[model samples]
Target: MRRWLVLGALLVLVLLVLAPFALIVLNAVKTPQEYAGSGPLSWPSHVSLDGIRAFWTRVDFGRKLWNSAVISGAVAVLGVLFSLLNAYALGIGRIRGRHWVLAAFLLANLVPQEALIYPLYYLARQVDLYDTRLAIVIVFTAIQSAFGTFLLTGVLAEFPPELLDAAAIDGAGRLRTLVRVVAPVSRPTLGVLGTFFFVWTWNELFIPLIFLISNDRQTVPVALGVLQGDRMMDATATSASALLGIAPAVLFFLVFQRTLTRGVTAGALK
Candidate 1:
């Protein structure tokens, strides 16, 4: 009886989570007139690609997708690399005040992005990086690295001491052990970190909006925001754009779902 009740609750939770996405997919294929006339929850009478086509053409979605991919990919790769180095130094190395360093990284992650925007903006202007993709890439890399370090630190701290000793006995240098031994064992954690950084950077709007002033340089989230007018009424197009915006992150998660589960579970087991 208890197991049945738990399964029932989970089924309800899944429905609640999927409801909005189901609505978006349903309305994305409907004509604007049809969508406005029908209830949002109602199914389309006939499927058509008109709405999505219009959104793609008007928003130049392909270009926005390319820009977002480049920025998010760079942020993910660099963030994971920097985080691994920091984690190796703090978690595995014989460093002083390592606990304090980990605490600092956690505290940095807790700082809200809103509070730092002004200083970042000023710094960007001074450095002449304003309105550039590189600016977003650099900022996101730093921001995500904090959280990545927090996660990877915990994973690396649980590494078997015997293995490290053995590697040392084998005359493996710190860099070599990190590259050959630590990295291979930490691939699962790396996948989780990279996926998270990619998704967050892909969906970020505020920083990109403020820093990437040029339309061509804007990411998918910021580009979608531009489509909204004071009295925006194109429901179908809006839905289509939103679906497109989330698609990449959704696909990324789906692809790495197993690795993410393994990474989280590995940390917990350790």
Candidate 2:
């Protein structure tokens, strides 16, 4: 009886989580009249692609998608690299001031982005990086790296001491051991962290709003914001565009969900 209750509860939870996405997708296939007339929960009477067509024609969605991909991919790669190096150093190197450094990073993470935006804006201007792809990439990487670094550090902390001793016995230098031994064992953690960076950077809105000046250069979230207006928005088209923007992240998670889950669990065990 208890097992049945648990299964039922899980099913309900899944439906609850999926409800909004179902609404979005269903609405995307409906005409504007159907969307505005019927409750979103109701199935469309007829399927149509008009919504998607309108969104594509109205918004430069292709360019925005590419911009978001480039920024998010760059952020994910750089964040993982920096995080791995930091984690390896703190977890394995036993460097001085490690605790203080970790504390500082955590504290900095606690500071809201709003508090630092003004300073970051000035700094970007000073360096002549404002309104540029590099600016977005740098800010995204730097902001996301703090938590990724912490996560990698914790995972590395669980590493078996025996492995390090074994590598040392092989006369492996610190860099070599990190590159060859630690990284291999830590790939799962890397994948998990990289996935996180990819999702967050792709969805990020604030920094891009502040720094991105050109509509052509704006990422998906910023571009979506531009799509909104005081006039009645094409409900179908907007939903379709949102679905498109979310597709990559959704696909990424679907593909790596297993590895990501395993890595996180393995790190916890270690």
Candidate 3:
């Protein structure tokens, strides 16, 4: 009975979390007149493609999707690589002032983006990187790697001495050991971090909106967000926009969920 009650409670929580998304799916199919007649919760009288078509065409969603994917993917790869190198030095090399270094990374991570954007924008402009997707990738790689460095530092600091000893006996150098041993062992953790970096970069709005003024260069979130105030989009179209904005992220999460699960399980076992 207790187990059944726990399951029931979990089911209810899941429903609560999903309720808005379910409504979005419903609203996306609803005509504005039908929604006005029967209300948001009522069954749609008929499926309508108008909202979806309008939002998709207006936003040039395909271009936004490609831009988001490129930026997020680059950030994920660069962030993870940079984090791994930083953690390796701090965690394994026993570098001097390591704690202070880790502390710096932590403090950097603690600072909000709002506090740093002005300096970052200035730096971007000085380098002629302003208003570019490459700028977004570079900015977020640095930002995201700050947190990833702190995280990977802790995980790698606890790495097994026996594994290191075995690699040493095999005449492996630092790079070889990292590539052949430590990296493989830490694959799950890296996967989790990469997924996080990708998702966070994909959902970013404020910085991208500020940086990328050109409509053709805007990311998914920025494009959808800028459209929120337009009189051309009604409530149903707004819902459709929301769905379009979130669908890629949802699909990415589902694809990487196994990696996330493995990372959690490995952490638990350790």
Residue pair clashes in candidate 3:
none
- Expressed as tens digits, the lDDT of each residue in 1-270 for candidate 1 is 999999999999999999999889998989877877876877888997888898888878888999999999999999999999999998898489998988899999999989989999999999999999999999999999999988888778989988889899999999999998999989988988999899999989889989987877888998888777534538888788888988889999999899899978876774
> For model 3, how does the per-residue alpha-carbon lDDT over 221-256 read when each residue is reduced to its tens digit?
999878986667888999999998889999999999
Per-residue lDDT of candidate 2, residues 1-270 (tens digit) = 999999999999999999888878998888989878986777899889898878867778888888999999999999999988988889878689999989987987898989989999999999999999899899878878888877678778878899999999999999999998999988887888899899999888888989997978998888777777534567888788778777778998999899888876874663
Pairs clashing within candidate 2: none
Worst lDDT 10-window in candidate 3: 224-233
From the highest TM-score down, the ranking of the candidates is: 3, 1, 2
| Alpha-carbon lDDT, every model | 0.89, 0.86, 0.94
Cα RMSDs, all models: 1.5, 1.6, 1.0
For candidate 1, give the lDDT of residue 19. 90
Q: Is candidate 2 or 3 superior in lDDT?
A: 3
Q: TM-scores of the models, in the given order?
A: 0.95, 0.94, 0.98
Model 2 RMSD vs true structure = 1.6
